[model samples]
Target: MTTPNESPKDKPSSKQMICENESSTTKKNDEGDNVGGGVESVDGQNMSIDDANETGIDDPKGQGSSSRKRGSTIDVAIQIGSGSGSGSNARKKREMEIPRGEPTCYVCSKNFTSWKAVFGHLKSHQRETPGALPPPTFTPTEGSPENNNDDETNPREQLAPTLLNLALETMQKMSEDSNMSVVHRPSSAFNSPFWTTNSGAPVWNNNSSLTVGARAFFTKPGGANFDRERIPERVVHARGASAKGFFEVTHDISHLTCADFLRGPGVQTPLIGNFDLVGNNFPVFFIRDGMKFPDMVHALKPSPKSHIQENWRILDFFSHHPESLHMFTFLFDDIGILQDYRHMDGSGVHTYTLINKTGKEHYVKFHWKPTCGVKNLLEDEAITVGGANHSHATQDLSDSIAAGNYPEWKLFIQVMDPADEDRFDFDPLDVTKTWPEDILPLQPVGQMVLSKNIDNFFAENEQLAFCPSIIVPANAPKCVYHNNHHEGFMNFMHRDEEVNYFSSRFDPARHAEKYPIPTAICSGKRDKCIIEKENNFKQPGERYRSFAPDRQERFVKRWIEALSDPRVTYEIRSIWVSYWSQTDKSLGQKLSSCLSVRPSY
Candidate 1:
């Protein structure tokens, strides 16, 4: 090895060098394939055996030149320093040297004259026994500086090219063994294996919390990166899996909406690093009004005191909201418990208004019909499956994609003319009711294919939030309206403008031209009450009737199980029985007979 301060001429010239050659041993394995016991040329390149032995490069195989293991070689070639070359490549090689440490191998406790020589030695060890040990978990002791951190006593002038290659390969191996990744920090970028409290100030020790003087749990006033460790979980649809795919436009509905993503036929909307069609398994929501959103979530969530979800508590809360009865039709059905995310249908529960470029408004509901057809786990199956593996759903989706069996869904939309809103007995806007498929046929729009699985659960699924709110409409014919109100908790938008509000000269956001405003009149005193046309029982009854007798029996059995809860109030049971009677007398009578109670109504 040549020192940095040494003159190029002091190093042996190319003519004076001779390469040592080593031949690898090969033998046929049990599988009748020739396996080399020594290094083989990578990428089918014609590599000189002499070049390999001279550089002391151990082949990835567990064999090398006998002289390498013994550290004795006389036919080594000398290489000129990186200074011999011009441009950034030379500078990069020079920068790779260990800045201030003695060229020492922490693993073998071997010291070399230069960083390059040390790295070459390390590479030989790695190639000899790949994956024999993990990367250094403990930080190596810092070497005392000989002078200022920049000065070095050793010269690194000879075999610079070979040594640089060895250094890079060894460093790469270290990164792989350590499971390191590049992360952007505020001060400077660095390689890390785990996420810190914040990227800017990394928590070198993540196993323990930041404490005061290593005794108390109180974090150092500003030292601990514990201020913002978590983002609020979504109010609903919190548990879900997301995927990457594209939404292609099959048919043009330019007259319906002006959404840029649906501009024309054959238009594709990329879901990765872009927008997502966040939806649930069922086609409708528990509440139509956003005001009831919080209360509805509270009722569905585990009880505040016990932290356990009880059907009795859920029933008591939703007993008053008859509108929820319709949603329960699907929720209690066999499909309520899915085998996995891919097996169910997705829906944009709310009835959204789609305005065309001509300012004509139409009410549309988005639907995703799974190409696999709807399949649900039976109640007993759900218990057995969930008991076996809570992450079975997530695993199934991942495994399917890995096996090249990409899940697909066909997109369809139900359109209703705003003028025909009151044509049906049920409210068109009621989320609890699904428009009769016979009346409003599902018009084909497009299809979506979940082709890619997310890389990180927390970074992708946990952090991902979608709102019917985050819409972007262009001047395209099918451009749709944008509604973005629920912006809180882990909102990851970086805005750098003075005015955050809209309609300003400096602001870019503004209402689009020819956007149709709903003409429905709003002339009512402020009141808090259920929707007047809450015909929730009718839909549930229809849904119950649509099911086969066996399916209906299962549905009633589920209801009976819920009504039999020890904590369920008699009044609540009576009210529920009365509601079921309104939907179907037979269904009501069956529940009453099972519960040993007379029909309330």
Candidate 2:
């Protein structure tokens, strides 16, 4: 097989020659199928070597060509002979007996009618080759000892390259506990010794169908194994890592709330987390009203048409909602991009009410301060780190827990009296506003320690859910809270009572003793209007002033870049500059200078 310029000195060894021949043969076998040179046919259509390779990999007998050839023959025969009268009758019987199920492939999201088909498809994804090399189509070499070209008692030769590739793949998949001994079993559904149908009838020979003396074939398609592998990803915090831990009460807040989870000091509940403290790395949210939540998310998400997230889209969307300015101050600030989940702080974001045993109500806001001081990645740093490993934060958290560097967070609350709500210029319940630390200090409540990593992320983290409506009676506002009995999607709760309504005579569930709550009074015609106290500029101006000189310049530069987008209209640019000028004159002037656009205000 040498070229015209070949020398005897450059002639490859027997092993090298075997490898070259096998590699070329495998490539030709795969490519030839596309060019209509394949040997097998299924249902009047040519079957590629790639399909054969998939079957051969999943074949329990191994990837030998003899095993594959037998399987292919059986498949071809089954496909061609399936249109007979008896086969038609059998299919009709199957259709009547078995309901159709669309089992979806988890990897590719492809749907199949039978378990056999889906499982067979999954085998293709499971095949792993070395680096960029394709999966080996193992065909036995003629001169190899296993199938020697010339039969002999004694053999002296190197192993075939196909076998070598298989050996390397097997070695790569071996776990660290490979040496551990195990007792083998052939128990029910425990790695059945023989191939079987879904109904437990052992398949005598997988290569051929069960036949009555070659008169008719009675091959039964396996039942569909429908796998609901994933739950709907969270709308907001879709990408996050959660760790298990207990929230221990450190302070006596019995006067604050009569929640069983918050009963008294030293009292604890196993899984009743400290008020489902659902929060984000950033304290403030993008929108204030619940009505705008969906729209805000739509804008923040990838474009509907292109499916790509662009800053221009986000900036344009938020440009309409000036109240989002304060939030963007933090979003575009020095700590805009967090390094990891563990290093960032969290907030409840919304104001809640707390009732004392005496029925006195107080407005409360919750916060979680990380024990590890807050850390963040700069814009350049975030791009580089995120580009390197998209799952860097998740990996960091898991690695830290495995290495025993457990992360901890301290719980704190800021309480305000009902009358004092008017004392502040901003609305206490407005989610867009942050209760200043200088005015209303954070009260120490308890601490949380995530010492253990979850065993199964899907079972624990993915299925886990929480809702603000799940609040205790004491934390719930009297006039605002009401039962609508609206069941949500993916509600995992189990209830088995005929009476689903509250206050039913048959139901034993009774309302807790009344506690004092705010007497919220509303007297207005239903109309769409903006909040009267939308003093959106002051806090943002304060935030801008609080930043260091260099940081402020960076912030201005970022705004300038966003405003300079050719897609951004002159009106939008003027509006943003005017808004910034309202916040800080110097900032507006700086941006105006960079973009060569005059501030409207």
Candidate 3:
């Protein structure tokens, strides 16, 4: 019988015999034959070809159906292939295991089966000395074995040319358009055109102010045109600074909310923000629900008779609504007199819902934290700053942007699951309350950077209006308003049924027709409209308790002094006593003791 290693023209070489021995120690080879002959076993016994068949062990070499004894030792001569011995074997093994395909480099066009080979090739192409040769041009390798161009045009190259041609054609067409050259007439000088009455009739030669022969008959310009240049200031947020900025989302909260703005990172929405401290940081107030908003503003505003704001008027108006006490704590605190707009924080001051793509609604509250951190000026600082410049905040915002030092505010929202709203110590939907960051953590949404200053104060800043109703891509879930009849007539009368139409009509199919419906529909619910019921009082109470015992005493003393004012009525003082009692019983007792009055139930 012919042996496996025996060739047609050559006797089996010693190296071949050793290889056959090594193969017999392994599994069967390619052909069905036993080829083991030479090679010493571990026990110093040479494995012979007959030993493989005698032991009845399965073929050790994968080449053939030969069998050998287990643990048999074999000696084999090592053979070198065409290239590096071990390295060439490894390459052959990998090539056989890994399917062959065209090689491509992601970074550079240099292609090689091994990246190390590509690296060596790249180094050789580089000039040895600095500036010794021109930069290697990335020419399209054509007809070289490396280039595999199957068609006349490369798809990417063809796309580039087509886009360039289309762009050029668009530019040429735009150049020929008549609208491109249209000119708009600019407004003439204010007084040179002769200031006119509201009727538009010119009032010429007004140097003497409508005088009778150099003797002034009418002192003012014209009674009718005198007040034309002036308009009524905003009822609230009257003293404020306006800034333009973009709200960019930095967090991925798509799972917790359906609001498009908080869906992912890098989404930006245009915003015009206003900061005010007519009496508090939280302007555009959400008092005891939406009904009390107009009334609260009316009470806080300057009296119609004196045209001067009096603390007595505000205290009396809010006294009936005991919930106003929570807000009063903030308004009475040092934060009420922030020296400049930059130092104060902003809050939505209402509970809103975050709807996710799955239609899950989570109660949420928006907060704006200054990147510079909270720094409030004391009463003395406010007196000095306000006296020095009434427009200090506006000037600061404008100058900061111009100097390339933009002011930034990080936007965060405290979210609570709707089912867990009642689990908190305070109501989440109450406008009079504030969320405690310790319990319900503040999740960062994004940042607002005021980089650009408005060009026209009147056209851009003054005329711009912002309502809580505006819904952008990232707004929270919708809200419903409900009212109790026990609320006063002023409050109950304002329970806007037309506004809270969503709850009445549960059909979402009708939503498209009412897509742009104003937020006016849901304005009457007290808990939903007022202090965000979730996370409100706990934060204030913690803030109050954080003060040293002595400081807390001083705070109660100050409150008592304010409440004990002779102008403040007994009922108002009693209401305040109860309010502080709810905040801290000891605080209320101390205040009542200082006022020299028994604590009212």
Whole-model Cα lDDT of every candidate shown, in order: 0.60, 0.59, 0.51
Best by TM-score: 2
Clash statistics: count for each candidate: 15, 1, 41
lDDT of 3 by residue, 296-337 (tens): 667887887899887778778877666665665666665666
Candidate 3: global Cα-lDDT? 0.51
Best-first order by lDDT: 1, 2, 3
The residue pairs found clashing in candidate 2 are 359-516
The C-alpha TM-scores of every prediction are 0.56, 0.57, 0.49
User: lDDT of model 1 at residue 108?
Assistant: 80
Model 2, backbone clash pairs (residues 3+ apart or across chains), number: 1
> Residue by residue across 1-601, what tens digits does model 2's lDDT show?
3334555465433212111211222333321111111122212212211122311111222333322221211111111222112222221111111111124454465765433344445445545432223343434444444575442211111222322233233222221122211212224225567777667788654432233332122332321221121237666668777676677788888888977767877765444343566677777877765545555677788887899877778878887788898998998898998999889898989887788767788889989999998999998898999999999999999999889998888889999987788788887777788998888999988877777888877766765556655632222222333342436643334445466577766655667776666455544533334455778888899999999999998898888877777778887788788889999999988888888788765
How displaced is residue 575 in candidate 1, in Å?
Answer: 1.2
